[model samples]
Target: METTTATPWLTEEQQRIWRSFLGGTTVLMDRLDRDLRAAHGLSMPEYEILVRLSEAPGRSIRMAELADAVAHSRSRVTHTIARLERENIVVRGQCSEDGRGVSAVLTDHGFSVLEAAAHTHVQGVHDYLIENADAQDFIAMGRIMQNVVEQLHGKNF
Candidate 1:
């Protein structure tokens, strides 16, 4: 004989909020990606990777670190980097310090592309979310998402 535990479920309000979050995020991400693609020929993930490289010291970072920074899998980052390399946006080279690690370096062209794309991305973010959301609600949403990220990642993200 086995004992069974009852499954916990969300309350009606909780379920409604969760569904809203899911739908809203899906639409928001799609719009952002579409805008970037239309204006810059860049996908959201690629834009994120370029942003990470741009912020790193020397505009370069180890491939593993880049993947981690973007919260993407190593293989996914590798594939994206490959595409960027083909476009002459990024180049991969051995890390000078260790010589055993590979790093992705953003080319000057990549930076220029990013600069142009930033305007579109930022405006989309503002027009779709920030401008429409109440300031206090936006701040609270940020805090709530940060907490969720910390819980999931086991550290502040």
Candidate 2:
């Protein structure tokens, strides 16, 4: 039988900082997602999924690998892919090397959509994050996020 260890809870100050971080990130993400969707009909997660697939070799990647790249669960990726597939923006194909492996491919129409949407998304990013933040703070934030990502996945990107 496996025994579970109880972790210590956050102190008042720690909790405040944690909540602040969570709140800020949540609000920022919501705003960005809203902007992207309003302008391009793509949720942030869907946009990220599409972007990753677009950048992949031959505009295709294994479903599992794509899920990992975007930090999405396999199931969530599948559901989102189904939606994209219905839109004719993406297609699923069997891997030639491994019969069991599935790959997501971005269609030409999808690429066109992404190219148009990226402009608006970048403008939204500039308005929400870049325009307001101090240069040093922006740099610091990138470093902090990079470190957190590295610690979590430890993958060379």
Name the candidate that leads on lDDT.
1
Q: Please, what is the whole-model Cα lDDT of each candidate in the order they appear?
A: 0.94, 0.91
Clashes of each: 0, 0
| Model 2 quality (TM-score) | 0.85
lDDT per residue (tens digit) for residues 18-39 in model 1: 9999999999999999999999
Residue 152 in model 2: lDDT? 88
